[model samples]
Target chain A: MAEVMEKTALFEFLCRMGDNTLILGHRVSEWCGHAPVLEEDIALANTALDLIGQTQLWLEYAAEVEGKGRSADDLAFLRDVWDFRNVLMLELPNGDFGQTLMRQFLFDAWQVVMLGHLVRSSDTRVSEIAEKASKEVAYHLDRSRGTVIGLGDGTEESNARMQAALERLWPYVGEMFASDETDAAMLAAGVAPDPASLRAEFDAIVLPALAEATLTVPEGDFAHKGGRDGGMHTEHLGHILCTMQWLQRAYPGAKW
Target chain B: MVASVEQVWDWLDAVPDPEIPVISLVDLGIIRNVAWAGDTLQVTVTPTYSGCPATSIINLDIETALRDHGVEKIELKRQLSPAWTTDWLSDKGREKLEEYGIAPPQPAGGPERCPHCGSTAVEKLSQFGSTPCKAQWRCTECLEPFDYFKCI
Candidate 1:
C-alpha cells in the first residue's frame, strides 16, 4: 500500500511538470508567424518546440509510472482542461509580444531553478530527464532574461508595456511556489524539492533581471491557486485544447 | 557473415547527418553507443535538442543506412542521460561546419570569425536560427548571414 501511494504521488508530480510545459508550449507556438519581427517569430517557435519535446519525455514517464497502459499521446490529447495539472499563469492568453516575453521570463526563471534541484533527484529517471532538460532551460532563461531587460529599459513606451505585463503576471507567480501534499510526498521520498524551497533561488535569478530591466517586482503575494491541483483552470485552456486535440478527438486514432 | 563492431562503426561513419549533410552523424557526436546484442545491432542516439523535428528523420536515416549495409537486425535506442552537448562535436565536424559556410560554436557564446570571409567582425542576428540547434549570425565584413551551431 505504501509503495502504491508513492507511485501515485510520483505520477502526479510528473504530470505537473509535463502539463506546465505542454500548456506553455502550446501558448508559445501560437506566436509562430505572428511575432513582431522575423527573428522573434523563429525564436518563439523554437522555444515552443523545446517545451513540447520536454513534455513528451515527462508525460511518457508519467504514463509509465501510472502503469495504466496509457501512452503519452493519450495523456496529452485525450485529457480535458480539468485533468491538466499546469499552473494558472500558463493557460492565460498571450496579451501581447511584451506580455508573452514577460510570461516566458517569469516561467523560465522558475523552471531553470526547479530543474536544477531535480537534476540531483533520488529518482534516476527524474534526474536523467532533468539533466537533459536543464541545458535547454538554461538557454531559454538567458534569452528571456536579455529580452526582458532590453525592452524594459529601452524607451518610455516599451518600459511602460513591460511594467504592465509584470503586474498582470505577478499574482500567478505565487502559485508556482505554493506547497501541497504532493510536494510533501516528493520531499519525503527525496524524489524532488519542496516547491517553496525553490523561491530563494528563483528570486536570486529573477529579482535582479527585473531590476536590470527597470521593471517593478509588483506588490503583495496574493496567489490564485487550484490549477495545479486540477480543481480549476482559466477559460483559455479549453480553447487551447480544442484546437490542439481536434484531430485526435475527431478522428479517434488518427495518424500521419 | 557477422560484421565486426569496428566494421559497423566504419559503415555508420559514412552516414551523413540529415540536417547538416556536410557532416556525418558520428561527427555530430549523437551516436553514443553501438554493440551487438545477440543478433540485433543496438545503436544508441541522443538528440541535439529535445524537440528537434529532425530526430525522427535522423533515426530513419540511421536505420536505412544500416539496412543498406546488410545489417538486418538493427535497434535504435534514445538515451537522454549525460545529455548531448556542443562539446561532443568532433574537430572534423567543426571544420566541416565552417567550410560549409556555417560558423562553429564558440565558448565565448558567439562566433569567433565569419565562415564566409574569415573576418573577426561578426554580429548575432538572433539567438535562434532556422533549426533548433543553430542561431542566426552575420559577418560584418562580408555581410553574409550564416547559422551558428548554438552551444547547449
Candidate 2:
C-alpha cells in the first residue's frame, strides 16, 4: 500500500504544478490587451503562452501515470474548485501591474530553483519536463526581476505600490516552501526536491533582487496553506474556472 | 521495401517550418534523431518553445511527409532532454533566416543587427514578434523594420 500511496503523492505533486501554471497563465492572459504598454501586452501574453504550454505537458503526463484515458484537456477543464491543487498565491486577483509582477517574481524565483533540483529527478520523465520548462521559467524570472527593479525604484507612487504588493504577496511565498507528507514521499522516492531544503536558495535568489528594488520582504510568520492536497482555495479560483472551463464544458468536446 | 533512416532524414529536410517557410525544419535543428526499429521508423523532434503553436503542425507535417514516402510504421517522439535552443540552429539556417529578412539569432544577450543593411544600429520595438520565436526590431541605418529570432 505504501507504493500506492507514493504513486498518489506523485500524482498530487504533478497536479499542484499543473494547476499552478494553468491558473497563473489564465490570470496573465487577462492582460493580453490591457497592459500599460504595447510591448508589455505582448510580453505578458508570451509568458502566458509558455506557462499554458507547460501546464498541458504536466497534466497530460499526470493522466498517463494515473492509467486513466483522460487527456490534459479533461483534467484542466473538467475539474471543480475542490479538485484543484494549485497554491493560493496563484489564484489571487491581479490588483495591478505591480502586484502581478510581485507575484510572478516570487513564484518564478521559487520555480527556477525548484526546477533546477527537479531536473535531477530519478523519474526521467519528470526530469525531462523540468529540463524543458526551466529554460522558459528563467526568461520569466528575468522579465519579472527587471520590472520589479524598475518599478520599485522608479518613482514615489510606483515604489509605494510595489512595496504594498510585496507585503501582500509575501505571505504566499511561505506556502511554496512548506513541506508536508506528500512532499516527503516525493522527496524520499527521488521524484522531487524537498521544498524545505530549497528555502535558503529561494531566499538567496529573491532577497538581493528585493534589496535592489528597494522593496521590503514581509516579516510576518502567518502563512495560508492546503492547496497542495487540494483541500483549500481562494475565492478567485472559482470565477477563473467558470470562465476558463465554459467553452469546454458547454461544448462537451470542443475543438478549434 | 522498408525506408532507411537516412532516406527519412532526406524527406524531412524538405519539410519547411510552417511559420517561417524559408528554413526547413532539419536546418532549424528541430529534428533531433531518426532511427529504425524493425519495420518501424521513428523520428524525434524538439519544440523551439514549450508553448510554440507550431509544434503540433510540425508533428503532423512530419507524419504526412513520411507517410507519403511509403513508410508503413512510423513513430514520432517528442524529446525535451537537452532542450532545444537557438544555438542548435545550423549555419545554413542562420543564412536562410537573414536572407528571408529576419535577423538570425545572435549569442544570448548579444546585440541585434539589421538583416536589411547589416547594420548593428537597431532598436527593439517589441519583445514579441509575428510569432513567439521572433522579436520586432527596427534598424536605424536602413530605417527598415525587421524580425529578430530571439536567442533562446
Candidate 3:
C-alpha cells in the first residue's frame, strides 16, 4: 500500500506543477495587449505562452502515465476548484510588472534547479520531459533575473515598487522548499530534488537577486505549507478552473 | 566522379522548420549533410536543441517530404553529442524568417540586429517569444516589434 500511495503522491505532485504553470500562464496572458510598452507586453505574453506550453507537455504526460484517460486538455479544463493541485503562490494576482517579475524570478530560480535534478529522474519519461524543459526554463530564468535587477535599479519609482512587490511575495516563498516523505524518497530515488540540497542553492541565487533589487527578504518565522501533497488553496483557483474547464465540460467531444 | 550535391540540397530545401514554418531546415542549418549510399538517400540532421518539442516533428516532416519524392529510404540521425546551436542558420534563412515575422536565430556577437529594419539599435524585451525558438525584440527605427530567435 505504501508503494501505491507513493505513486499516487508522485502523480499529485506533478499535477501541482502542471497546474501552477497553466494558471500562471493564463494570468500573464491577460497582459498581452496592455503592457506599458509594446515590447514588454509581448515579452510577458511570450513567457505566458512558454509556461502554458510546458504545462501542456507535463500535464498530458502525467495524465497518460497515470492511466487516467484524460488528456492534458481534459485535466486542465475539466477539474473543479478543489481538484486543482497548484500552490497558492501561482494563483495570486498580477499586481504589476514588478509583481509578475517577482513571482517569476522566485519560481524560475527554484524550477531551474528542480529540473536540473529531475533530468536524472528514475522515471525516464519524467527525466526526458525535464531534460527538455530545463534548457527553456534556464533561458526563462535569465530574462526574469535581468528584468528584476534592471527594473529594481532602473529608476526611483521602479526601484521602490519592485521592493514592495518582493516584500509582498516573500512570505509564500518558503512553502516550495518544505519537503515531506514524498520528497525524501524521491530524492534518494533521484526522482526529485532534495529540498535540503535545493534550499541553500535557492537561497544563494535568490538572496543576491533581492540585494540587487534593493528588496528585503521577509523575516518571518512562519512558513506556509501543505499545497503539494494536496490540501487547501487560495480563493482564486475556483474561478480560474471554472473558466479553464468550461469548454471541456460544455462540449465533451470538442477538438482543438 | 560524384554527381553534383546541389540536387540533394534542393530536395532538402523543401523541408521547412516545423515551428517557424517558413524557412527550410536546410536554411535553418539543422540538416547537416545529405549523402547517397547505394540507392538510399541519407540525410543528416541535428536539433536546434536536444529537448526541443519541434525536433521530432521536423525529422518526420523531412522524411515525409523526401519520401513523397520517391527517395527510397531516409536515415535521419539526431546528432546531439556536440549539441545544437542557433549559429547554423543561413543568411537566406535569416531573411526568410524576418519576412515571415519571426526573427532568425541571433548570430553570436552580443545579440542579433532587429529583423524588422536591420537596425543594431534593437532591445530584448523578453527571453521567451510567441514560440520557443524566438525572443521578443523591438527595433528603434521601424518602431515595429518582432521576435528574435535567441542564440542557444
RMSD of each: 0.8, 1.6, 5.0
Record all residue pairs in model 1 with backbone atoms less than 3 Å apart, i.e. clashing.
Answer: none
The prediction achieving the highest DockQ against the true structure is 1
TM-score of 3: 0.79
Native contacts retained, all candidates in order: 0.86, 0.66, 0.28
State each model's TM-score restricted to chain B.
Answer: 0.97, 0.95, 0.81
Give, for candidate 1 chain A, the lowest lDDT window spanning 10 residues: A226-235
- Supply candidate 1's per-residue lDDT for A206: 94
Pairs with steric clashes in candidate 2:
none
lDDT of 2 by residue, B14-119 (tens): 9999999999999889999999988888899988888999999999999999889988788999888889989888899899999999998887553467888989
Tens digits of per-residue lDDT, candidate 1, A1-256, equal 9888899999999999999999999999999999999999999999999999999999999999999999999999999988899999999999999999999999999999999999999999999999999999999999999999999999999999999999999999999998888999999999999999999999999999999999888889899898899988988889999999999999999988
Question: How big a share of the true inter-chain contacts is recovered in candidate 3?
Answer: 0.28
Q: Write the per-residue lDDT of candidate 2 for residues A173-199, one digit (tens) a residue.
A: 878988889899998999998898999
- Order by lDDT, highest first: 1, 2, 3
What is the C-alpha lDDT profile of model 3 across A1-256, one tens digit per residue? 8677667767776786788788888888878898888667867776776688778767977797578688887778877777776767788788998898889999999888888787877877678667656776787788899889988887999988998888777877878787777677676566777665788888888889878877667777465555555577777777766776778788887886
- Candidate numbers sorted by TM-score from highest down: 1, 2, 3
Better of 2 and 3 by DockQ: 2
DockQ, in order, for the candidates? 0.91, 0.70, 0.27
lDDT of each: 0.94, 0.89, 0.75
Model 3, runs deviating above 4 Å: A1-6, B1-12, B18-22, B26-109, B112-131, B136-147
lDDT of 3 by residue, B2-27 (tens): 33458778878887777777888888
Question: What is candidate 2's CAPRI-style docking category based on DockQ?
Answer: medium
TM-score: model 2 vs. ground truth:
0.96
